[model samples]
Target: MVYTAPGSAAFSRKRGSMADKITAELALIDTELAAVELGDIELNSGEILVGNAGNVATAVTPSGDVTVSNAGVTTIGAKKVGKAMLVSESEAVAGNIFVSTGADSAIDEVAVSGDATLAASGALTIADSVLDGSNVANTSPDNVIGAIPVLYRIAVEDASANNDITSTHKFLVTDFWFVGGATPGVAEDTVQLLNGTNAISEAVAKTTDANCLVRATQLNQSTGMIAAGGTIRITSVKNTNVAGTAYVMGIRVA
Candidate 1:
């Protein structure tokens, strides 16, 4: 057996053996380092390193609408988010709206199916008569003819007989008409209107001299504006002369 000093060949051999073991261990470390080398990594600009299984590092290179920097800074591209990403665009239209049919579901259009519909020309129309006078919910007038005065219709039968005609109610005399039946009142015969006894009209003519059929409007009111319980008296110069049928037309005052 040879005794070897610290600097001797045997001692150097022992050191070499330890160095060989260290080199073998270092080889494994070098292999692992080579597997994760910067050259092996395919990271471009805007990339971040991510650890895989068993501590294997991988380069996460942002693509498409996003990017990552070598410093691990990340950014997303602009205008990449479109309507298709947000909604199911199969039902999209110009005037249509996005309507969610169910909760937690994607929204789309149901434009024409609703009460109102829109045309392709951007003209919106209500379905059928949905917005007409009948369907519209509103406080309508109980009487549609608001504030319009009613037409006072005098019955033709009431003024048929030619005599002292007394009105059934208080009346405002407006017009008078006459048609000869066998014996018509003469043209000069004055058909006077009276409120009880006081005369309201000067002389309402029964008929014209040329013809028995006569119509006159706005009879003169002498006594006052109107007559209550008025009487249509045939006052003739020749009294007791026969007179035919006549109509006293007026509005009810009372």
Candidate 2:
């Protein structure tokens, strides 16, 4: 039988059979329910299976923040939210964070709040960089400032030439020494300064000793002997010794 809508309650009660048929036919319309309100709702398994937006289980509040519990995967406003973490075991992190589990790891820019301590497996080098510090500690080999100019040691010995009174023999001077002798009689076993060789103002010579002796000379620029490139030769004039020694100590000014 066909049912007609009327405003009066009597019509509804009288058409009770028609109403039952109408309700059955309209069951599909009820599936498209608008909103639901409930004190609490619990689902028993197998009773309801929620489809995509086919059904909306929960909705956002007016505040725009969402909280979920025990969800394996969820999404909010296009951002995927996972349960605990987003883990990448095989994939790599490009852009800023680059991590190589096996070989190399590098970060483009890193900022630490306090001091930074770096530990390296191999040698760590900060090349072509200036370290601003008042003092520097050198823990390597020998530290060299500048070159020092100094005569180590000198020695003197007998002359190699035979009776060469007028000629001068090249005596290997071990250290700075002097000897002297009388006029023309093998000179004198004396410690006297040579014309251009002796650095001391007065020539020093030993009148009697055959052994070599040292002559003190000023360690300054005024003393022509032992200057920068100047060589001081020890000559055995009256003394037979042709070997002597001289030690020089000076700093490199230039």
Candidate 3:
């Protein structure tokens, strides 16, 4: 290989070959780029092209509970943000949550105290059993009322036999009623709830003996407490011909 002048035949030939190779490479690149453009570059919801640390463009998708709007605003679904994503001053304690102590202060791990408490499993509980108007908070639902609903359990026994408050669990007998059943006798008789020999509720008289009607009585005495594994009974004095079911309503306290 001998040195040649700039306009020499060999120099021109070498330049032309170099130009041809560069043009061919550029044309191949253009064809590959066109294929990529025409192919399905479909991305899932909240997916976008992002340049990673390696300076390579990658298709990235948000978590299941996250959404990204076309306007570039990202939204996180409720209960989606975990403690790992939060800023905390130290290791989070069991049942403790991150909170802003004050403006311009580091986020702190604070335990929910007073009326409310959080469990290590992320369950929350309130010390108070009942909620009233005063405890209600102003919320987005407007006039948000917090209430603990009392669920009453029902015990039913046919009039043929007394519904022995035979429940294994302690039940605070609140209300008792009789429903007319098959073959209600001609004459109406008295029905009442009892704890041992003492009557817990006032005796209720049947509306009629035609197997048609009955009465309800609310136990107004503390004697309505049915001890667990204890004998609390319902006694009905209906005639043998009379048939009905007695329903005792109460809440399980234990």
Candidate 4:
């Protein structure tokens, strides 16, 4: 039998066994590190990293109109806001204003719908024409004639005949002038206005001697009003004297 020393082949075999175990453990560690690919790992554009409940990290892509912070809070982009309002191209007309329809994000340009008129110094004009006098909504003197003053003139002869003056506009008799006629007595020079059987001015005496008889000195204190589609009848009764011209003027205010 041979006696083996501490540094013999049997001792070398024990050392070789320990070294082989350590190499096997190092190989296992290398295999796990290669699976992670730490050297080749990179984040793509618009890509982010998120962690799940198990603490496992994962790559995520974000939507174009929104962004997510590291804290997981999301926010919308400015251009992606909903229901933005904008004006159209039809707002250039004069005397016109823009109005928003009840519809969502809808608007239009139109003439002022309020009861507005052109100023004395304003040169602006609307495309809409005057309303007809017969329209019930167009009240006379102001709206019927577009607030314009009008005069209805007729020559009256001193005869026992009634002269009826008919007008297409509703007006207010503002003034009267007897140019060529002499002053007739009461019940002799009579002028009356009727608005569909309603007497606006009844039997007003014209007693100014060859002059204008305004409402100030007339026997009737009522405003001589002629409605739309009404008539004014003037009857001259000569008190043994009949000669001259009578001119009637009225102002329109509809």
The per-candidate count of clashes, in order, stands at 5, 54, 4, 8
Candidate 3: regions farther than 4 A off: 1-162, 186-188, 209-213
User: When superposed on Cα atoms, how far off is each prediction in RMSD?
Assistant: 19.5, 19.7, 18.4, 16.3
In model 3, the number of clashes is 4
TM-score of 2: 0.26
lDDT of 4 by residue, 33-88 (tens): 66676445686655677897889888887777898765567888888844223333
The residue-by-residue lDDT of candidate 1 on 1-254, one tens digit each, is 22222445554555457778557556666777666756765766766778978798786666888776667676768998677876565646666656787977967565665687777677877777464222322221233433222122222221323246554444555566555444445545545444556654555555433336655544566543344355555443333232544455544443
Candidate 2 residue spans exceeding 4 A from truth: 1-149, 160-187, 190-201, 207-213, 217-221, 225-228, 240-242
lDDT of 2 by residue, 1-254 (tens): 23334455654555458867568546534643323334235544223324547576544322233433333233353454342234353442222232344535522322222233223333333434343211232221122563323333434334432111111211222123332222221334333223244443233444334443446453223453333234444344435433433332333232
Query: Which lDDT values do the candidates have, in the order given?
Result: 0.52, 0.35, 0.61, 0.55
lDDT of 4 at 163: 64
Q: Give per-model TM-scores.
A: 0.29, 0.26, 0.35, 0.34
> Could you give me the TM-score of model 3 versus the true structure?
0.35
Q: Identify the superior model by lDDT, candidate 3 or candidate 4.
A: 3
Q: Please identify which of the two predictions, 1 or 3, would achieve the higher lDDT against the true structure.
A: 3
Q: State the local distance difference test value for candidate 1.
A: 0.52
Give the winner by lDDT.
Answer: 3
Q: How would you encode candidate 3's per-residue C-alpha lDDT over 1-254 as one tens digit per residue? A: 22223445544555457778567556666776666752367765557889999999898876578778755788989998676687453666789877888979978778998888999899999887655322432222122353222222233343544656454555566567766555445444556778777788876665544555555545756677666576666676755444455666554444
Evaluated against the true structure, the overall lDDT of model 3 is: 0.61
